[model samples]
Target: MESAIPAHLTVERTRPARKSTSFRPPYPSFSARFDPSVRQVVMAYFGVQHRSATPPPVVSEALAHLASVGGGVNRERAQYVDEAGYHTTVEIRYWTDPAEFSSWLADNDFWTAWPAVPDAGFFLEVVRPTVPRFETLFSNDRLEGVAVAADGLSGEIQEHGYWGGARDRIPLAQNDLLAPIGDVSARTVGDLVTVVPNGNLCLIRSGQEWTETAGDERQMYLTEVEPVLRAGMDFLRDDGLSVGCYANRYLRVLAADGGVTDKSFGLSWWRGLEDLETWSESHPTHVAIFRAALKYLSTMGPAARLRLYHEVTVVEPDQTRFEYVGCHPRTGLLRALG
Candidate 1:
């Protein structure tokens, strides 16, 4: 099928030159789900490296298959390469029952097939929010991001200052409830429970316009901004900071025709709001990157083909829940509260 995406913006998928080991399931159990009304959601990141500016057939096929299955996923969106050179796609699935999602994952062919394909990479993070545990703010009336992905997640559309003002609205608790379910506290290869700081889970979704036309602005984003953002994620994942930060992912929005757009998203799991603030404000790496990005966007203005914005949702322990099935031992919230 011909893609509606213009030739300049079209990104063909590419496979790795060589093969690698298959993704082995890390978690002891794969079947876990909260009540359907609670809006259990999963963000699955699937991608492949770009070779010669075109994506491999497998990459596109895998994405289509994922979207086709539905798997209780009410909505789906995708993007090609954002700043990250990898041709990545993300699917936000809402399952009425957690088990249904688990069953789909267990039987999905892409789970086994994609990894076998040379140079393909995939990871899934499932988030289930309890009532009154989470909050969302949007700038536009359009239903986008996680709000569009699930029911009962919509919020009032507000302009820029809303994020700053949101802090006061978020309810505070004197104690943190995110502790390991069992007694173990050290990083053991197969240990189920691990100790992590008390805090809430925060999800930030923000980005801007994506034009089919490409130029210097697109080039700069891919070359400059992408790397810096990637480095910050890497630091959080590998360093094992004083506060809890389970995982972080960057995704591009994919159109209906399987073409990628300019809009990008950052999905991260944090120990709490304070830790997230520390990284955003005090962390040298993050601070420098923010400064650079500001300058870049300011210079490009309307020509940049990108508009960046963000909304944050922080869920307290009782208000948030997570489940894993067929996942690695330390994946999602399970890593901290095994």
Candidate 2:
């Protein structure tokens, strides 16, 4: 769907974390995991507007109620996402009945009830929802690595971080898979994916896996073990490890039109990528070991490959500076996004 917000004010971004070109569902798409009970979605773009007098509590309450106001059966999750320097301070997003949009305004008393926040330079924020008219172009899913030991806390830890907007958690610990990547490229990306109190993101790992023969049980087991995921989490639990650039997955759940894969995506987000080094110095231990495992597995045989993608969003500036369209620095052509 075309965006309802004006073109100039919207801040668009992308990630390079998703690259699952290898392992796709045997069918065109996977079966739907969560039943589609909530059909309508609403996206709210939030800005600081009046930082001094703005009532954070009131705003918070309004957001909380917005989820249930529409009344759907599907587990409607609400998340707030923000990227530093982006025009919008926060983006409160959710899905449910479209009709409730009116109720959201009335119950919240948005008319005159908005915190007597300043009006002059309110920093101007916008909240608009737009569904993709065509299909979405990405896929996302949560694959639990090997959950070796049941800390009984894995679920809680994941929930906490998932809700907190801490996009990726490996690099801080120097995940096992980092050395091969960081050492080889250490290339920095100018993008990031952050989760707010209620936001979420996704990851992707793909490359030519060794072809399965009639009988080849001698494959590397550590990389495919289930406990590894928990191991990664445990590493995150620990404080320090080595420092290096790590890869973080980015997931944006736009309406997919089956451009990439012929399979249906699950409760996942569109794919994107991020470099751990660009934001911080170190990575968690579990992450370090985990990444290493991936690299080692890559060496074994089948060429593990998953291309990454991401986005850099900024406000519309003067038309003169509007560039990058078809203007290839090398060939100098005006080919832009269709």
Candidate 3:
């Protein structure tokens, strides 16, 4: 495919080109385009925790409750085992309008009832990032998480296939470095704990899907690329504080029957956008993952069946609410302050 860089976006031509910067993907890519009138987008995670492989009744109950409310433009379900080996079933939903999200939360009481169920851990993490504070990139046109709430996909975007593409895509990055401000703090009310975020808290949901690959391609991705990806995610989740990352969860997208699927994502919280970019550009773990991915893409060429995508959002303090009920202190964003 011919490269079609958007005229509105510019690159620093004088900078030295790395392999990623020099190589252009054979496949066309796209980004989500939000409506100009829409000011903010909300990404909410409703999760229920369990120790056993089988989810407790409240997990399904929470899922059913979300289904009944049915407010967001997009919703997805995933599960992850935390550092302590606790399993959490999560449903993530996205909304473009803050008013609609507020109404939905009010109607559902934000899963306040889940705490009453004995021994069940629950959490509600909602981030309302203004349109400019977030960015999206997809290897293919298939829409996923937050992107589904977008007005539409762009026509072959240019701000990809490069290291700083994510930051370049974010409008705020044009004028601001998007540094961390203040500090994350938590307040406890009985069994519930609410974490108040600082300014410019960065959140990223980076996903991969290999469902379309078969034979050699599938084997290659599973054996070569995924291991590196998992290692990088594990690094961020386990030893990322030296950098600005607060916490990371490598979550698996679960099937309806509670089986793990071919999909997975790394959900992480960072101090700011600059911190994330620094890690992506300089971290050895990430560099290995990037090289493996580039090799896979170049080798597979057009036939590569793996789909990659990510959505990043930097939320203001006022635009966030992270509440955990009957949950471990390390649950979700709470670990940032804990």
Candidate 4:
């Protein structure tokens, strides 16, 4: 099929008409519905890296400090080996309001407590987006990631199962270009480095869970769908700079014992919302992934047990933060600055 997007990018203040108005999901899917009173939400990723087989003392101490200061609506954990060959453990946390997050930080003096140059690697990445700037989609009734903090799941949303659906779900995209402005730059002082992010930076956390699958459904997802997904992720991680992707990390959700589980996600950063949308609609890598997923869902019909979901956001410059302590140059948003 030819791409629905134009070769040249254009900006409009009003929401553009969707090209796939007839599009509908083959199976039921839902989007997160936040409370009307809520104005903004925060998503923070706290990461620690080590060369050892297990987490070091600093990691335990950091976790304890985080527990004592508790303020997030929900939290989840994941692990991955970065390109630099270090074992990275990450804690993803969410908050429904920016004031609540600010109060938590101020009450705890969170900035002063941690060592500026920790013995182990550490980084903090934070994004605070208004309710309208972010969107979510889920393949199952069960909540995951940021959706865990939502008021409820929408009743079978119509904007999904096709390219550009993610853009359609975001309310701000209705009246803004969501175009990126400026560039990411870094400044270092001693062993600490702070990254200044661009305006309208985009972030996505797309996940998969197959724990409930059995029989033919299990084989199909593992053999057909997952391989294609991983390949697309790998391309974004390695060669995607030419396409506006800044960085990518394919992470494995970890169990209590730090063992790998049936869930995993590809966390990525993009230059802007338009860049991400263009790649998803026209890139061959994503095309293969979309086709493979559609085939799996079609073959299994309603009984398909595999679950997929994603949350995408375009954050303003003032609403973003990135800091690193004794970490490699390529860690997290540092790659963008690099």
Candidate 5:
């Protein structure tokens, strides 16, 4: 059976890039916006410690509970998950104001419940970066406890399961997928990932589904899984892929506690268009994933196909979220501080 790219470090944490820091390639004729086009954007990165005996499902259920209560984060997307070695990553995204968001963080009841979570005793980073675009293209930076190629493509993304939701936090199953690869600081973090900052141009495509009960097995041609497959084959292969990301039913909890289907977004590292392009074509494993994506699509019948739902963002803030965030890398993940 396939496991996460072999763990380079015995621990889950890693150090910042030691090789060399270069701007991720830049988007051609592109621009950068401080904030997404939506009301606001906030993300949290979590690294769940991987244990030889512990099951990943245990971690998944713990996150599922946090996302349901208004405890973890309050936003559009409910939750997320990514894999590296024995670690798992979680992120949340949504529409809200800073003050209200801060209030949610301050609530003591939330963190109290965090410890009981699977791998809860691990490390995490609470950060808010300058969202260069609406559809976030992510890249991982080497830091703290990790030792891997400074360049992206350290290994293949385990591409574990994902969960997310929007509008109402409804537990929508089968619409989530995670596409994670090794540390992606290679080539460029500045260029290809942030090509468009157009709020009007970006759109949130959701509700693409194929239900088993639908009974039309022959109707498998029309499905959301197509874009997901395309994302790996065409998008990741051809587009500026600085950092790879995964999907989740809900990365955050909501006030209403209602959600549906999983969602996706970017991380702090991905940038630079040129570096992204170079890795896509040169990376051996990436090429392999693309070639195999077609076969993977075959496993998911029309009902198991992907859904079409995404959010288009527009920059409304003159200043960026970095103003409020203090991030320092301890493990492979960034640790957020005041």
Candidate 6:
């Protein structure tokens, strides 16, 4: 069989050019205070998958419950047939009081009901981070992510350097990186993994937009493009690639009315810049997918209603924090510790 990857798409990888360090922070004092009341955020991923074509009914009901009733749940992004070949949905929820979230988790009925569904597997990761430990950036003014869940933060990080010059701007305790925050945990339906954030982290927030008449273009992505992308992710996760990638998630943006939208965002967690670049440039799977995606976009032409964009931010270890509650044995930051 001929390979799906085109020959033109295969290109040699090269190192990026070094840049001069002439740029400096334009502001002398740039620091934001956190509101005392804003304690933590519960970032949860609820995923389900089955070998059969259709998922169990309980899976749908569980997702609907998360969308409809969960308090402190503010923003949700859903996706289907992810790299793991599972239907996954993530929600960035805020907690004025951590006890409320704990109360909901203590309820065992939902947990018992899900696993009993035949041939189904469900996983959940609830990450709680202190308000002051992480930084965020948004391309649009609309409040989202940490912004929706927390208060007392600066708007848009405008510092220079890969770490966002975060060390200078934000204060850190001596043992923040090595020490675990008591509140964070990760869990599957069966087991809960206790984990902590250990080192530097990077989050890439990227999005795509499509024109109104681009309904067909959207379908093309769902039918043709997304599978290849998901496959590449599976390759990364299962086969392994460059050393530093910790986790990657692709989420479909949901409209205010709880319907899926043309837009989607990807949250990729990395150990450092070099590993991320190595995978992006030299990984055979990524290169092929990149080429195919480009070809598809170009074939659509200027009249096409599709547009894509993304932004990357490197977060310092102290500037970011992660705690996993009831996560599986190896998930997220726990993968490294395990």
Which segments of model 3 are wrong by more than 4 Å? 1-27, 116-119, 256-258
What TM-score number comes out for model 1?
Answer: 0.53
Q: List the global CA lDDT of all models.
A: 0.47, 0.23, 0.81, 0.80, 0.29, 0.49
At residue 280, candidate 3 shows an lDDT of 93
Q: Per-residue lDDT for 85-164 in model 3, tens only?
A: 78777889888899998987787875746645555688888899887788888888788899887767777765567777
lDDT of 6 by residue, 207-240 (tens): 5554353567778777677677767666656544
lDDT of 2 at 230: 35
Q: Is candidate 3 or candidate 4 better by TM-score?
A: 4
Write one digit per residue (lDDT tens) for candidate 4, span 1-338.
21111112223437764745566555677887776777789998888887666667777788667655667998788988877777788888899888988887677545323564333688888899987788888888888888888877877766666677788777777687789999998878876788878999999999999999988888898899999999999898877677889888899998867688999999999999888988888899999998898899889888888888999999988898888887876777777875
Best by TM-score: 4
Rank by TM-score (best first): 4, 3, 6, 1, 5, 2
Model 4: residue 35 alpha-carbon error in angstroms: 0.9
Q: How accurate is candidate 2 locally (lDDT)?
A: 0.23
lDDT over C-alpha atoms for residue 167 of model 6: 24
Clashes of 3: 0
Q: What's the distance in Å from true for residue 299, model 5? A: 15
lDDT of 6: 0.49
149-241: candidate 1 lDDT, tens digit per residue: 434322222212211223322222112322233221333233122233233556555454445426877777777877787677667655534
TM-score of candidate 6 to 2 decimals: 0.56
Which wins on TM-score, candidate 4 or candidate 6?
Answer: 4
lDDT per residue (tens digit) for residues 1-338 in model 5:
11122232112223222112232222111111122233334444333444333446645665566566563332333233333223333434332344554676666223223333333333333333222223211122211010110122223122122211110111111121112222222111321111122111111221222222233332432343344433443333222223321111112222234443333322222222223323434555445443443344455433333322222222222222211011112222121110
